[model samples]
Target: MKRLIAYIMLALSLAACKKQNVKDTGPTTVVTPPVTGIIDTSRTSWWQKAKFGMFIHWGVYSVPAGIYNGVDISDPGSGHYGSGEWIMHNLQIPVASYKEFAKQFNPTAYNPEEWVQLAKDAGMKYIVFTAKHHDGFAMYDTKYSDWNVVKATPYGKDVLRPLVDACRKYGLKIGIYYSQANDWINKGAANGGFWDVAQNGSMDDYIDKIAIPQVRELLSNYGDVLEIWWDIPDEMTTARAAKFSPVLALQPRTLTNNRLNQNWTGGDFDTPEQNITASSGGRPWESCMTMNDSWGYTKNDKNFKSSSTIIRNLIKVASLGGNYLLNVGPDANGKIPQPEISILKDLAGWMRINSESIYDTYASPFKFTPWGNATTKLTADGNTNIYLHIFNWPGGEKLHVPGVKNQLLSASMLANGKSVNGINDDTGITLDIPVGPVDNISSVIKMVVKGKLQVEVYEQGPEANGSFILSAAAADLHNPNGWDDIHVENEGNPNLGYWTNPWAYATWKIAVKTPGIYKVQAEIATEAGATVMVASVNGEAVQKTLTSTGGYGSYRLVTLGNLKIANSGSVTFTLAPDPGNWQPVNVRKVILTP
Candidate 1:
């Protein structure tokens, strides 16, 4: 018996040796495909290349920084010093009461070159500063109104001009954030009437006389403005939007946010506040998020998101073919808080190593994995490169991709030039992921493929039965329903969110106010023969499961059991394969209805 055992051990050792020899033989060598087309050089593409930018929310609000007359005037509802400097407008503080802030608003140490240089050092390609905030105070020297930094304060300097000049000196693009709506001094605007008791005048005349001319001055004086970041155009009419459209005629290339008019006709791109949309694939979109809680400088605001979170957020936005406009509010003394500076420097270090994956890259063609997120961009040679952004590294050293038909040429870590080994099969692509926390922030994996991008989609159920219609291949589930096509979020982390094909997943969290027999359906396509899906309610596993049989598959009207959700309770739906091997599954819609 001992001899027999020894023989078996010898056989096992020989087998292991044989396998090692096969691996040592090395991967197959194949010629790469020829280049197809040049990159689209439209205005949209230029903006997309600018994956990361800086947003500065500075103005009269910096003077207050959440304090008025030695009293903490922070708003309790939204928090953070009553939206920075807008507290005066929001609280309806009388002009006489608020005018006192202008006296101490003298920023003696303010240097536009220092600020713009800091942004350039951080690898930011663009800078967007607040020219006029909701408080009706213009940061630039404007001919239209007396309520401006150049006219109202003791330090009567045109802040915007110097900043613009500094940006040009550093070879960075410059933009302006104008709050055309909710101006406190422009009586023609409806919200401006809040300060009516201070000045007696006609509102319409105030808008025509004060607001329009100020806008013209901003467009004419600023040299080669790249964008106009408009905000909160609530209750604005088409006529008002039409009035603003001509201003852009002055600079046809100037990109504007959707907020220029509530109708969204004037803006060049859809601006989603604080979030990225899933459906922004092959479209223009920007995510404007504040560093802390408010856009303007706020004192005693400690709720700033960690640098890791901010970096992850930027990666997600970039992965989905969207730009991230990160904001920073300087204190009343015109100094960026120490914490913000540290965060920016750290982010710049990270960008220095992994910028190739972000800068000048378009969206990826692969679907977002349940455990991670991916973005694809075509190289100059026309070969598509997919970047896998791992937010939460799995415990194991292997990543299992369900469906991929194209042969992989190479795989490497974006941070360090380390080669990764894996297997490619019809079942899926399984790569050896590095073990033990790779980075403090997210890590990117670049996968070079040989052929045109292809993907298979799977649906939870049928559309006719109960599934919501999936519009774009990519949609952001976290944003409001109509906003999915406008912004892109969930960029780098695959496990956190979902999008359509070539777009990240936009899953919906539907609340059942009234419970009844509801139909749940989804539209999906997959490359494999069969795929499985599971649904659950409040952590309780549901018995029903949907299956797809063939390529480019879908399901409709998969009825869920009668649900009785209490008013306070919530329901969640998730999708995955049964055998757990599926790739590039495009989920178009998930509809729930009685």
Candidate 2:
């Protein structure tokens, strides 16, 4: 629901982003600059280890089930297009009309134990359920408002307490998803509405009388809340955000996400929606993705992601040291979509065999791999365990791994525990790949390394076509003076630019097989006169004087003289300015073709 709103806001702000450096204006509100807070590792250790969880966006939105007044929620002809949860805002449904759906919101078939069991069987470490959403409808029995399930709905019961109990009974942690702002039904609350006169009330009054008290009720009543999932801080200022901090302080160990208020700096983790965002150094993060196109249950939404994609996404997130909070939206009758259940069953089967590679794993040591991703962990015996999640099994007998400097102790298939052979060299190691993948979806190859994990930077070998591409994005920059301007950038494209320092250089480790004469071409852009650079390999060198290719951003591939290689082995390749006659140049990549 918040994800859909975010995309719309991004589209509307694209022009401003192109004109100047623009920051994210979250849901019609200005986001203050981020504040840094001391991160307590002790408070986050359990969450970091729990790399996967379940997200439930169940709400009264399920009552409409993506249809309102005989029109589809996303019907283009009706001029409405958004997620099921945003039906009220997108279709401009009045608060009075929207409240009528609450009368029909019944979940008699909702079995808390069944939901918890499904999550546990799917190998999820925790479950985060929607307690309240943007429509100002609470799934729980909040004393502050009659716009709650217990007082308004036919089912007339609190949904959260039983879910929490079930999670505890099944030894799984539970969290609550609360929308602290943009309550459409509450008078004076900030909301996306012009027609609903009932929504005209003081924002501060809504926060004090409704949002804050409800938050306090949720945190205090729910025993041992694992996380506090706040969404869409539309008009929540820092002062308003601070009101909930004391309520959260009651449960000191409960984790909170960044969306409570973008200005608030005391979040335990970042919540990146619908995408596997890159790791922010070692900061805790989670990607909340849906099983299909919608976060809330849409009866007509059948755009379900494949089981393979879901599995690989989980692996990809774990490899990057983040959690995957996969979502499932239950219908009004409390039945999960059939396709979602089937996907969960598939995940259950896969996790039953390959979960050891995921749990408590650190980020990959290598920068990138052709086949798939990797995760590592330090063993109790002082060794390192590298779990290779292979999406594309190699056709040849050998599966190459670059940049690794550790000695391989043992290799085995995690699925069946069968021994695999590994051959080591200075460049990296190669695993004797099996005839076929043990599991076709994604095979986990576990390799134990001796001592601490050591990986050489910017090391690579030839692709299947026997061509070596030393890209500037992967180059190891050497700045002896510590103020060298030479660095990789993406101005027009990804290239090494701002080469003002003559002493600084870039290098790559290449493992050459089937040694022979290879054609070398460099993609460089420069306006300086007759810039000379020395490209060197094991005792052999090529000194080339390059001509201008129009401008610094206008790149052209110019052929550089090739040198002979005496042997087929790993060697260092260096590109440095010719000391006496050096000029600035932007380098994209150097290609060696045999």
Candidate 3:
């Protein structure tokens, strides 16, 4: 009872802290006055607190449903496909033929209340629905264009109005996604290239006349547009992007993504699409990914990620201090597919049990952990609350948290509130966990630390045998070319793979106690020809030629000559690719033998 009270008090204090310096509108209502003067990061408090949101991608594309002329738009074998939403662009379908889809665009079964309720049940705090997709067909009643749901479709009503009302009724924030650029049906808008003669109009006129007016209606008609999602700023120059500023100024508190302009002017947060990017520079970011392969509904794209995958993805994003905007593509009938609904139901179950570990938690202090991820929250009494989301539970019932120097207060299972004990050592704290996991997907353990948190730097030290084993899992990846380009792959064993970028490298911090001459051996796998790799430590470096091992899955251990270490307490070992003669390889581990 006391612990629960402490948690409640901590949550209230954190809520107060999030709203401290931000502009106060009336009584914390959803709608606020238009943003005036300088807009700071405090405007993003609601969104930052909302760690998860639902992304809806519905449009005329659902009418065709990734199929055109009896061929799948994304059929790789036919060599004629892109995203389901870009079917018109990829097929270069004439406007006359594409406009025919609007005749069949009637979502008779779309219940706004049901949709909003699902999101709320799934623990999503907000919803970003597609008002207008790249197809240039609006899903709402737009006076600016006749190519809208009200005028063109059989169901002649504004879809967004009811959705907004439902959100307000259910206490879920509403957002609008408008394709600012690359409007396929609109004249004079950027359409990637001039595929059709009708698309050869001035881009500025489209922004000024159609785009800006539609944006104004979206912001005004909607009670409080909490988020304005701008997609594919292909030709959105600074001047053209600047034109939408005044319209957005009306809803000053609305959070805008980075896709508004090429320069990212007025963008409140970064939007990383389709992948979870590394974070911790303090800038707010959200990763928008689809449950399946396609953002829009594709009839054949049944490759939905499992409920476990979705839960883990959400946990991973929270651990990195970012939000996850999961996409759901409803069919033409306005019904979220049964599989998608099932996934959400499963997610709702998990969130019911383990959401406290996710909501309002900051990034983990530890760089990386093999078992799973961690999220932290500061308590009201200047202590720290750490949630250990264990994905891979230890078989021996011992969970080691390395490099933590903070004094442990209490540990408990998040699911059942059962007590868990911990022991602090020279390495870190180790918790004695239950024999079986509390939850099959992810079992969270809530831990409280006394006073301010403290952690030791993570460095691999020599074992009792006086030999150092630098595993790939412990290496800190340094890649300027984003997260997906070069990263740690977990096929069978976790190894640093997909190393195509020459500029990317991996570093492992080492603490050498008994320093002396050591023989180096590296476990690597490569399908390509011999590549030069430089392994450097303590100002001494050695170049090793990595020969092909027949296939990327095939692993081989090659010995690189010895190097003398005069004296060392802490040193960094960097394994970098030779840009001049580099071949893609997977590094499993590096071993030093005394």
Candidate 4:
């Protein structure tokens, strides 16, 4: 009986060993990766397909075109005392200024079809026309206000109506930019209106009599508004916004921006003006920037961003999982400036070739590095693809990437459809970029992973050479609060001192979980008497130093070599001041690309 039992136990043990060996030989099972963050995928529904769009800033402001009373009136700096868009109001030019403009605003060559055709040729998928600017003059016909294009102009036409119709006919989505803060016309309505003139009128009465009624007219007149770009409602309170939320019911799916109220009570998305933020995981965001320095038509404003600059900005925004709405200011004749049109066409051409990296894409699992930007998208089968945008290629055939550990399926350039080789290791992935510089603009490399990509970032201190930190102050500067934090001193003020003569100093302690090459960058300003500024790691002086002059400075990227850190390693950063008391320093942002 004992011998029989021993035989049975031996058989059972053999069987278990065989099962374990079989499991080791078979393919490994992969668990489904977690979604990074919840994004209203619906917000991407429209913008993803419509990869590129045009913003037309045409309004009564265009009529003045930065002039008043036969004189070129500039904004506050140029000896004008009003918002550039409010020149007529600041100079109190009265109805005469507008009347004269009306006579010359005939726009005899204005053809809606021609405009739409030009946009289509340029590859714009949508158009956002200014229905009303700060001037309070409506471009569309509205029963609620007599100060509209149909009633106030010699042309006596609803300018926006034909544009909308033409856009729809040409397969373009239509968006409207509405000035919720009325300037000249509806001043008595709701919280003193645009010019902030407090009249003895009830807020509700003004909203009911003018604001809401005009909004209702717009929704009813337009076929279907995809977005409502509201601007400059500084006086609007949360209660006021709640009262106005019902207006959105007229067009339920329409997207709204955060500018309508101080608190952004009913905004569908956060609007970052002229700047893009690092990804908030999966938060929805849009960057609205003007073609020129000014939002409205300014004849003397020659500060237009170049075509390449605009395209780069768009890509940067997209890489951070945000949309870009580039603006254009038309002349008084209702014609887009030739220069602006040229830039848009160039952007459109680029989008046609490389938009796959942008449209329908999400923020990459890897953080943005000094080498360039990065973005990611998911395939239909749930496989994930990452795109690396290299604006300043390292000029080498091979490039190393850290913090990625997934199996790579393929690597290729999205522009030319050329395949590239890559090496995958436990630390990260490395790809062989094209041997030579292909173009002056940025190039994208696509990396397909078997499943979702996972990565975490750690910072090491100055003592641990090559470690970095993105200070709280730098993060706060990019907050939606406002551009008030854009000053030179505020750039890296709270964390790293400005690169000025009087060197202000700050100490940063960073902890790193792994050892790797890390890159550091800071936004610094230069003023008179400013000399070279230095940064040191762990009391060891860094070789790279930045020199500045008296002006708005550019971002200086500092490459700290590979750092070796075990678990719980820490490092510190120190800044040395230049000789001078000049407070001509600012440090806006600091990036630690590990």
Candidate 5:
């Protein structure tokens, strides 16, 4: 998680981060009460069953909305701002000057009950709010530091207390997002992703003086906290991370993520930020993502994801046996952005009709689905309910569900009780699906199975007639949990692609029938400069130089000189970024012909 390389060039003077009116602040003091036991994860089943939650990133940065000194940093491609939450670090606003914004940070419209009710309506079971962000701005009352909402702002009230109370009243689990590392105001850790070369205090001092005390305060103050989400472990050493373990004992069932230290092995869960991990290997994880591109409120940030996108994403995470922590960045007035509110309301409508498809659901029992994500849950009668979330409703009545070998009891549209008939066979079941749009965003079809659900493994696709198309969807992604996997790419297409890292690649398996000198071609889309793709099969390889097809969807055909095939057997094909030409490439389909 070290972003120092990206920000090293943008680092500003340390004096630029201090304010003239800064009051003398004392070092944080902490007293860890005696705790004797390790955290028991028995109660975390509730979290796994919940499937969906809310993430709120609110702080003094919302006041600026990414503007400073008449310059707008929030605008995309501005290159002036990175994360809205880290604008202080990005823009180099001194602590003294940043504190002045506290005078205008009063969120008069803030109502905890309203927030909690909205979450409930959306079918979200939990709320993880920013108790303290990396700017070292505490939203709660902290006795360890005076740089908090209650101590510095005109609001002069603890924001977290009411939120905790309301969540408890509404029967929603609550969690505090504490940036345990990367404190902009703490000594040594304040260097913006890098170690401070001119630091005057030791990291141990910061850990003992601030982090432990603030964490202790949060755990003690919050009622039955469900999680303590720590962000950016760039500065957290193994020993420093151990300090929080004592305080974590206070909340036996409260979970922590794996970011305490970059490579720290101790955490209750994995937190994949902004993008879904391709695989978690059965470990509990959550994908925390922002509705828009920015995590915090930015005035001109209008890249809000559609309600349909949000619903599908939630289903995507839930179907993968992970939770979806969708984010909402409220404006400075304490009101959730109207776009975000409308999106939540729209999601509420979908949840009303399909919550059962999500809650307590297991991963799909099949290898893959062309329509969309699938979920399953056990019924009282010992039946397994398979929920097929149809993103692209197959036009025909026969919806092919491949590789399912379970006894089917019944199939019906979840939105309504309408029955759906299907033919069950060895390859899988093919349902005689009902016509018409069941739901605009996503339609859920519930299929009941007789016994323990099981699915056939994926077999190598046939290369009939001496030709085969290896789709990006079936490619072996280089970065398992990155944006390059099963998500929408530019050009409004779903494929394996990324515009940033040039070295990213995807491999595919092929059936080498009638192996010989086969003509190989690639259908690609790009939004960047010219690049080359090295297509290697077995031991033979060829490079194809490519030009941008304009956008991510504007794909063009490029031929890689014929590759020699040895014998007729299973073969491996790898498409990788041609070294030295670090440009973006999106390969949708790799075609091999004899």
Candidate 6:
């Protein structure tokens, strides 16, 4: 009882820990204000406390994997655009052709208990299965549409029912991801916005007949769903979004994503797909990413992210007050592949040691660090429990924590309960670390400090004239595949997003010492021309087209024009394509010069 009281008190005092002086930037930087009532409101979500979860994108697409009519999907000419899950639309397989997979969709090996047990063993708290993706193939037993699993498949059973039951049996929170729009079953699902099929129907009839009723069935039939993950609200309007409210009224506690309309109209949280979202105004957001390049099974694609990358991504998400919904694409036989299975085992090993740092914690109030990320859970007392997840551990006897004012009570390695000597001085707190990292993945340095945390956020670099060089390393690649050295994009091309996505973006959260219309110049080298690089301060943006540098990797620094800021604060620069289409470019860094 006393502990509960202490926890409440800690929660109340959490806002006081936000450092006013720091330049706010996430591992990948982009601070989007979350919608009201849905994002981090007075009523905290149980889903937020349950930090980690699983995202499964399964359907008839698993049967095709990547090939359709002997056409290689990797080739753009093959009409294969996006992930393996979208193979139906990408290959332009007629509705008649795509329906053939449903007949053969017999997951006789689909063991719900095994899948749930695997998730539990991986230390995942929840599961968000793709009950229905853009393909419009419903995995659940839906009475509204005959295009569902029970009627269409040879297995002739509700695939999702056993999974939901098993989740309940295993004490895991389960949610359903329903694609609100883009029902390829409706001929026009591939194209964005509204498309009418003369023979089949309009999107409106599809929604009224299939979408709304199916949602109602999901909430009513499923026992206590934590989330109703919605996707691709292309052409979704406010009125269309309103139709979902009745469905949500069935399950008031169930959270929805922001993509309910043209903008983030209806959602309990912002969903940053395949990338860590930069936390803003303390919003409740999550990053849904896949293990491999594709969300669903892809036979030819073997570019699976390492176990260490998965662990680090989790830390990065937690550090920014978001959940990590890692994905796995099961095969047509409903078995998770070997590489994905191995990665989950690795995650389980890591979580067993460091889940305390992840689950039930808000973003760290302290400033950012290049080495890694941080997360803080307020203790029963007013003291803050800070978890320093050292990803790029600099080999040194002493680890320096600059500009933090707090009374350090204890310091220990989470992996091993070995206590480390702490030294607090005017230079900030320095911990005496061992000769090597405690764990190769990410070593957690758990520090329990008394009272609220006081952290230094802004670091001023040496200015020459009126310009400052912002290192490429400091800029946050706010995408899912945004790593330190390499740029990662999970979709578009089977290889990555960078090559295929025209709207690829990276951000830099610059702590401007001099607030003015500083010249924004980017040191870049790429093979594309007529490409747009949009530089912006906050949301105010300016664009300029670029010609190719001498060649790929041939370098040149070009001025992207100027951006104006009102006062000395964190100025965000979003480097992305101009507007309509995906443009390609390789960026080193953006420098602000007067």
TM-score of each: 0.73, 0.74, 0.84, 0.75, 0.84, 0.81
Candidate 4 lDDT score at position 134: 60
Query: Who is ahead in TM-score, 2 or 5?
Result: 5
Q: List the lowest-lDDT window of 10 residues for candidate 4.
A: 18-27
lDDT of candidate model 1 versus the reference: 0.62
Candidate 1 segments whose C-alpha is farther than 4 A from its true place? 1-41, 69-81, 190-195, 279-282, 458-594
Residues 1-594 of candidate 6 have per-residue lDDT tens digits of 233223323432342243233333212221211121124443346778788899988999988888888976745566565688878766667777888989888888888898888899888899999999987889988887688888999888888889999999999989899988778784434445332242255667777888889888889988888888888778777888888888889887787877777665447777767666553345577788888788998887788988988888888778777888999999989898899999999988999899999888777554446567778876787887889888777878888765556778999999888998998876457899988998978999999887766665544342657566665545443332211113433211111124334433555445566677778888776677577667665445667788889765576889988877666754545566654533567666577776
Total clashes, candidate 4?
A: 17
- Candidate 2, residues 1-594, lDDT tens digits: the string is 233223323432442232111011111111211111112377888887888999999888998888988888655566776688988888788888999998888888899999999999999999999998888889898999999999999999999999999999999999899988878887776455556777898989999999999989988888898899988777788888988878889999999987877453448887767766432334577889999888999888888999998998899888767889999999999999889999999999999999989888887765557677888877999998999999888988788876566789999999989999998885678899898998888999999989777665333668889888888855655543322247666522568877776766776657777587777788999998798876766556677899899999788998877966667765556677765678898999999888
* Model 5 weakest lDDT span, ten residues long: 19-28
| Deviation from native of the Cα of residue 470 in model 6, angstroms | 1.6
lDDT winner: 3
Q: How do the candidates rank by lDDT, highest first?
A: 3, 2, 5, 6, 1, 4
- Per residue, candidate 5 scores C-alpha lDDT tens digits across 1-594 of 022212221221221131011001111111111110111258667888888999999998899987888767766566775667877777777766777887899999999899989999999999999988887889999988888999888889998899999999999999889988777765656845433333346677878998899999898877788988988787687878888889999988898877787564457777766666543234577889888889988888888898988898899888767889999888788999999999999999999999999988876554346687788777788767889998888887778776666788899999988999987875668898877668877889999987656554343454547577777655544432333233334324556655454544555545555768878888878776667667666557777778778987688888978988887755556666655665776677788888
Output the better candidate (5/6) by lDDT: 5
Instruction: Tell me how far the alpha carbon of residue 574 in candidate 4 is from the true structure, in angstroms, after superposition.
Output: 14
Per-model CA lDDT versus the true structure: 0.62, 0.78, 0.79, 0.61, 0.73, 0.72
Q: Between prediction 3 and prediction 5, which has the larger lDDT? A: 3
User: How many residue pairs clash in each candidate at the backbone level?
Assistant: 48, 2, 1, 17, 4, 5
Give one digit per residue, the lDDT tens place, for model 4 in 85-160. 6666666554544545655565656788877877776666788888877666788888877777788777788888
Better of 1 and 3 by TM-score: 3
The whole-model C-alpha lDDT of candidate 5 against the native structure comes to 0.73
